[model samples]
Target: MNTKPRQTGRGGPRGTKNLPPAPDNKENIDTQILRLEQLEQKFNVEGSNTLDIVYARQENDQHHATIQAQAAELERLKEIVASFHASEGALGPNITPSGSAAAGSTQDAPKKDKARKHSAAANVDDMALDERASKGQIGAESQPSGKKGKAPKPSAPTNVDDMAIDAPDGAAAVAGTGADDEGVSDTTAALARENAELKRLLAAAQAGPVGGPAEEGPAPGSIPRPKGSAGSDFNIQDAMGLGHGRKNRKNYKSIMRSCRDLVLQARIDWERPWAEVSAATKSKAFAVAEERHPILARFFNSWATEELMKQSVKNKRNRAYKHDGLEVPEKYAYLKANAAKRNPTAPRGRQAKLGRVDVARKRAEKKKKVATSSIKTKKDAKGKGKAVAPESDEDDVEMKQYAPSEEDESDCTY
Candidate 1:
């Protein structure tokens, strides 16, 4: 509150009355800080969403790979069951009592089957021994030659087991299979040898196969290749030699070229979804291809023509896309082309179909909500919508008659 006049260094002191209030920049700075923070938060949110999508895609792929493996295993089991079923006689088969093969107590089936086989072998051996003895072959072969006196006419050694029981020295006769001085001993030795042979046959029968039973694998085919060789080419087509036909045509490479050329020349709608093709169209295309190149018919049938078309069309499309020239949408790309979506349960493996998964993709889809939905511009009259349907998908491209088209094309993204 000084009353004295203020003095300036050069010109006069500026008057306080002429000076404007100091400008406040705090509000502007605060607004700018808030905007920067909001932008940063938005960027973080977008990055997190992208990461989540990537993780989901990876998880989905893993699930699909696991399912594929399980499916292969199930197919193998099916083949084994079919083979066994075809081999097993319905009834009057193995001597394990009637209905035993199909009844309970499966745990004891192997043992019972072995016993049955052993008993059958023993019975056959008895029949063979009896037949030879009745023919007097055993007695003729075992007549003692060194005895000085006229040898007693050897009894036709029929039912040697009973003779072994009745003989005065039965223990000695049964104990040794070696030929000895007396004719009776020679006959006993021969019978003992036959018994030993029968035992050997029984043991071999019980042992199952020559090298012992082979393990039933997780899947069946040829022996699986070592896992270490997995990274190298193991394409099924190459392994199965799909490119090669019966002797007399061309070499593998030349045949491959011909196949490729044939695919390019074949008439197919490359733009249309594979599932959208009519059955007649598929067969016609295959027939036409077969007419042109008779050899292709050997490698594939009408049902498999789609595979050839896909390979050729997509391969050419990819080369064009690399140079940014003949590119098509991802959906139309050979590798990327999606088949028509089926029920979510369609891809489930055997175990998954049995409801064994921790979380079913189908059930989860049912639970999930699609937040992004567009307004429905058309609705069907309840009666007409359910009463009749279009003859073909082509005929109903615009939708049902009751559900008319509208200019505002609002769609829901599922």
Candidate 2:
């Protein structure tokens, strides 16, 4: 309680300057433990936080890895699916199951491994079963229930004639019996013999009196024969056109020659009608014309005679008037008139006749005028003392006015 300051040697009270350190006691230990515990707790908290971070990182890594693995697996599955679809497309819709199963095994490795062994064993068993079944079916179908399962006995051969006799009608069972056999049988033998005898008689009749005496030469009383014994020669002139009456023969030859000429002319001038042939060859030989040759006769018949006649008339009409530039001739006019009578639509015949007459009169007038002009020119030249006079019809009239000359002879030919 006294407020006095107690003086000590150094900083604090102690047993001595070198006194031994305080013994570590429970308290101290406890305190130190407490501190250690606190430190440990702190360390644990920090460690726990660090561990949590590490664990979180590890979890994140594991999650990412798992995702990657899943992605790879998905890709692999996609590839497998695509391959499966491709295989299905290649094989037809009803492809055998064994083929598909085998293909599928390649994509699903583990499953395929197991399936391969199983399929092989199954195939073996199936093959054996199939063999047994085939054998059984064959035996059942082909063999009969006899001693030791042998085949049935075949029937014995039967005589075809006997079978034919027993047949109802038209059965193949008796077809092997030939008609010759039937002919030789008792039923047909007599008829066949009679047929042979009739055939012999027919052949004998066809021979035509073989055993008769040789035909003698015609008796002296027979009709008189030609000098050549009348053997092979015979007159065929009657059969041919040559044997016709003289007029008919001449007409035929003329027609034939004309036809030949027409054909030749047609060949030479392709536009010439066959009808003009008769006129062209009027003076030619029938044989030379060759138009009536046997080969050409067919062509003539095909081109009917009436058509040829029409063509001839047309050619004649053209030749008669076309050269002079005049109207058609009388023959053509007559034809036209007849045609008009047959067909009322034709032009009038009077017009054609008038045209022809006008053309003829005009031609005559032109010729007379030419002659008169020539005579007038000659007389004018003579009067002018330039040339001698032309002796013509007009001069004759002028000369009549002058004295007649004794030397002029009317009987003299010009």
lDDT of 2 by residue, 186-277 (tens): 32344346556655655544443357786656543333222321112322222233447897575555454344334333332323443444
Give model 2 RMSD, 1 decimal: 57.9
CA lDDT of every candidate: 0.44, 0.42
> Can you write out model 1's per-residue Cα lDDT over 74-167, one digit (the tens) per residue?
5665565555345333322432322133333535676654333333222333434545655657656445767688685565655657655665
Name the best candidate (by lDDT). 1
Task: Score residue 380 of candidate 1 by CA lDDT.
Answer: 39
Off by over 4 Å in 2: 1-143, 149-246, 268-414
Candidate 2 structure lDDT: 0.42
Look at candidate 2 and tell me the lDDT of residue 27: 60
Q: After superposing candidate 1, which stretches have Cα over 4 Å from the reference?
A: 1-236, 239-267, 271-278, 292-295, 298-305, 327-414
Which window of 10 residues has the lowest lDDT sum in candidate 1?
Answer: 405-414
